[model samples]
Target: MNIGKTLFAQVMEFVPWKTFGRIIERHQGDAGVRTLGCADVFRVLAFAQLTWRESLRDIEACLAANQTKLFHMGIKAVPARSTLADALTQRDWRIYHALAQRLIARARALYAQEPSDLGLDATVYALDSTTIDLCLSLFDWAPFRSTKAAIKLHTLLDLRGAIPAFIHISDGKLHDVNVLDVLPVEAGAFYVMDRGYVDFARLYALHQAGAFFITRAKKGMDARRVYSAATDRSTGVICDQSIRFNGFYASRDYPEHLRRIRFKDPESGRTLIFLTNNTSLPALTIAALYKSRWQVELFFKWIKQHLRIKRFLGTSENAVKTQIWCAIATYVLIAIIKQELHLDASLYTCLQILSVSVFEKTQLSCALQPDRTQPELVSIANQLNLFEI
Candidate 1:
């Protein structure tokens, strides 16, 4: 409950910063002026997450003032703006990519547990993407932002744990369906996707892998019934339907795998169409499962609002990728802390706590050695009237 216990500090202690430093050293591979080590670069990235500082100068200034605190966090010295900027601009992005993948894999290992016994026939994952607008004049080559600037962050989120399992970044012009091949999918896992990702070939690939999926049929697609629908007594929703696609049904080889789930929208008094390969479950159950995909949208909202990710400090493609990945890394750290604390706080609330407890203090001593404990945190929460415990 002592949320003031610098979440970033606590979580960073767990990450192998030294190993990352070694990675950077190795990447340098018999180089010149030494430059900044990986720890220093990570410090800057971590600082960006702890505070929404957008520029290298701001980070340098903050670190310079809090040198002792930075030292505690494993930063040897505050690198100059020029140095940090050059390091970011020149450093091989593949190193960062490898580092990120390693971090995610480690987190998954730390948090993995037996699948929840929800008695559901399948586990569900959701897929979606959000646009991170950039400066068109600055990052000119970025795709889909010919008039304006933007990048797409496509993610596959595990619905049960509200955790992102896989993430990919592409130019703004990239279609959601095109990124499907890059994501990791398990055989029994169910994927719920928005209309933007409706591609017959990709869906068929998932079907071929023995995975299940539910998606809204595009408006113009034709549907032919294979079985009469049974009505649900409580919700008045249709129970089941066998359907044939207007086009060559990609999954035609697996005829028994296709089913239609129909439900009336409570708000509009209109019927919603959902196509799925899962036939063992009832129609309403499929609808309910697909409905959970909205959680990914909420996750996007949380990141955009809480992480201050709308603005970009770097102009080039690499800089944009670095900033976005750092933001995600930050989010993962916060989520890990929330799990460690056994607190049911929302991500924004947790970030707010971290911002106040870590970044607001001018001195590292004040920030790290705050005389706050679980009781004090509870009291502060009560005084601040934060009911999101």
Candidate 2:
């Protein structure tokens, strides 16, 4: 099978560079490099991922080989490494953040259309964060521990499509709860989070906003008696009591009507508690939903392992954010192609095809072409007899 001419070329065609070009053009201002518009920067960013270019010099070399593709992506001229680096450092960070938000919105819309096909419910979103370790001495102000220097990437992923709906980056020392404020939680959406994000006030706000959440509660929390003893069938734990606040609780910043569930983890055999405003579902259902929170961990593994996020070329926070966003953007692009081509392949398999097809001198567009009708993905799956039901 001619992998290069089929899969790789097809994937490249799916990148929505036209939409990105428009976003960049609309946001470019009197930021000095007006000639170097958003499209140029975006093209450089996409190419960096597509080629696995180490630095600006490497980007220039890749562009030199395919100047036409750059032009197609809206670059008037290729800027030097130093010039690009200066622009990235001095240019307004808001512009890039806004672009990321736009891309995220687009991804959300695309995923929302066919949730069932992607194995997701409308309300389920997986929330988690991963640490991107860095060189502590250089990025000293960013903070670091004795053994590892890192930054945290907190993401709200729409599990239906494995697309990131909200993302934020912070110093490694920042608590996970601190990043919760920026998440985009729609009314009636179900948010699944781990113990690190166990904040009463935030969960309260979510409840007040008419949103539902399922999270593992901290071990030791104080609550008054509303119900004497109710057995939680899932973990076989008896609920001690439920409480309602007369006024707002300052410690948790919770409103008057928050419901707390006290339970235990069956697998770990440890006492586990959960706090939620959702009363419609039984406690067992809530426990089951929280168990599915492991999907976000799988996402972290997918990106770090498949996309090669561990080998970062930039040490600056902005540079790191840019790289991570690019990787996500690439993942989204491949997902779109997989759906469009009607390929019943797992995302990991698609990513492997993408990695080799793009970086191994094989074009992404060709590899993903429908007309070729190779069915390499199905053949491999059938040979392994991978379970797809």
Candidate 3:
């Protein structure tokens, strides 16, 4: 019998530790560090995310339980609770952020060949934000309200594989629309967002950058129909027209003709008013593009439920950012593993199986494979006879 490393150790094989070490050196992440290094820090936090460990004590205990396997997992030593806590407080979080971006690029390349679900050949992305609430007493640095504190995770998710193409972490006070101003827009890409990001100025900026945007029109939006476009009611499209904003500020902000489509969702029976800058696509296609925005929401829900970002182990801002970035890195690593192995299992299922089996010796692919060798039942005897009744 082959006695191998834990399943968590197997997953860590996908991480480019040497490249990460180089990044740490470049950023001076481990300057004068005696016991705990940057790689060890990330490993501990990443272990917490994968195993759903709640506190520093939990992480220490788990690692201590598996102390003999630490070296196999690329951790030179099992760090104490205080040592790990100090590393989280002081280590440069940018190292993990850079690592996450690098992994994201790889994941994007792998999924780029996938056909768009919306049937469009262009690049499609869903833009949204999820606010993580924090306790104001412990986290006074992140001020959201008078009594509560929080941070917003602004993300741009590629619709192809539901992979995050971009992520921006900001204090909770930042508005969702403002996040658009800092995003580096790719020309010819279609960005689908909710009504919360319906700022004509930002949308116009996106248009000026040669990108298209799809968002829900606000309830009190004032617009004048410039041209009535043809539409089909069979697909739930009520009206398709080219319109210009009528409000003084709105007109000044976005002086271009915006395409408007009113549609009734066949699934929800709710009318949706869609606003977009691209006038070429079919009216039904525009509505479908907006519907794809829900993928980002699902991404948020999945991470929060599976990863340990919601209930933080540390109260410091640095620790919070470190954990969140590590969580994202773990997510990207899983994505890479899934794509590289071409596994058919859902990401949640893969995570759940890997959490406890990290110490198993089975190959990841073999473990994830469906059991197809089960013997088929030859025949079953009828327990109930209709004639007997």
Candidate 4:
């Protein structure tokens, strides 16, 4: 961040605009138009997300009121509600998706060395999805039920630093299990999911890829125990066994042996059955990995509460995806800032400060800190003054 720039402009300085330009060129996002180019559209939508603007009209009115600061935010001009709406519908959503992924790569690297509670050295991820309800009449493209419509955000989150590594948006009719088919399998990584993704064939695929998985077993599963391993009862682990599927499909899909662990929670006294293929890790550690999957649920709740993905600005599919990806981009950008600046404030606090002080001409990093004392500015010969005397 530098002097003589709006806080919003300073916040956006972390983005790699040169890479963004290449992505725009590859996708032809700026083709045949000049007013709201790809970058400008992203900036305006990001502005809406950061400022909590609900509609295109609200964004238009706000930008109109703050006309002089639009240039600082990389918006060439104030777009009418209609133009912004059309731009949202017209621009390729993949452009924004690619940009979000680019930011994810950087964020993952920044948090790679983050410590894990499980004390495992291998990378671990949690998979889950959350549904957002919509109106059937307005969003006819996404048909969910007879009276209403909905969409799902299938996410794979890196537990380290709670960064989303992958996101897929689909209609509500899609089953949770289907997301596994398109998931990028990484060797030596551990994926923690729930029973909804317990297709034997798919789990076998992960096993063959040299990756590990921890998932809850369905009640009354059709598997026969081949061998039982020793377990310490005081640790809550009731039994650890090597099992083989008895059903025809399960047997055919996975001919190899599987490890199953039954553990009882001390407080609830309820037992849980967990299935996995990795035999090297301790049974308690595997159970703890399953327990950590709740982090993904917390992540979904966090984004839904803080971001603008719930009420959409456009009804078209492209428009919906655009809004979602921009929200994700804003999220990763904030995470990057938090890590780089070493700020003590929580994300919620940082967002609250940024939301109100976006256009404030002050030191952004200092203002976002938990301690908000103003810092003295030093003159820089290369920097031009906002107003020359």
Using lDDT as the measure, which candidate wins? 4
Every candidate's lDDT: 0.69, 0.66, 0.88, 0.93
- Residue pairs with clashing backbones, model 3: 6-358, 6-359, 7-358, 7-359, 8-358
Scored by lDDT, model 2 comes in at 0.66
- Candidate 3 Cα outliers beyond 4 Å, as residue runs: 1-3, 370-372, 376-389
Off by over 4 Å in 1: 1-8, 18-33, 109-122, 246-257, 359-389
Error of 1 at 8 (Å): 4.8
Clashes of each: 0, 19, 5, 0
- What clash count does candidate 3 reach? 5
TM-score of 2: 0.76
| Candidate that beats the other on TM-score, 1 or 4, i.e. the better one | 4
Q: In model 4, how large is the Cα lDDT of residue 105?
A: 99
Whichever of 3 and 4 has more TM-score, that candidate is 4
Best by TM-score: 4
Q: Tens digits of per-residue lDDT for model 3 on 1-389? A: 13476677778888987788788988999889898888888888888888889998998888889888888777887688888888889888898998888888889999999988777788999999999998999999999999899999999999998899999998899999998988989999999999999888889999999999999999989999999977788889999999998899999999989998999999989999999999889888888888889999998998888888889877888888888999999988998899999998878878888887777787788776557688987765856677895
Worst 10 residues of 2 by lDDT: 1-10
Q: What are the TM-scores, per candidate, against the unseen true structure?
A: 0.83, 0.76, 0.94, 0.94
Per-residue lDDT, model 4, residue 11, is 85
Report residue 10 deviation for candidate 2 (angstroms).
5.5
Residue 157 of model 2 has an lDDT of 82
Clash pairs detected, candidate 1:
none
Error of 4 at 216 (Å): 0.7
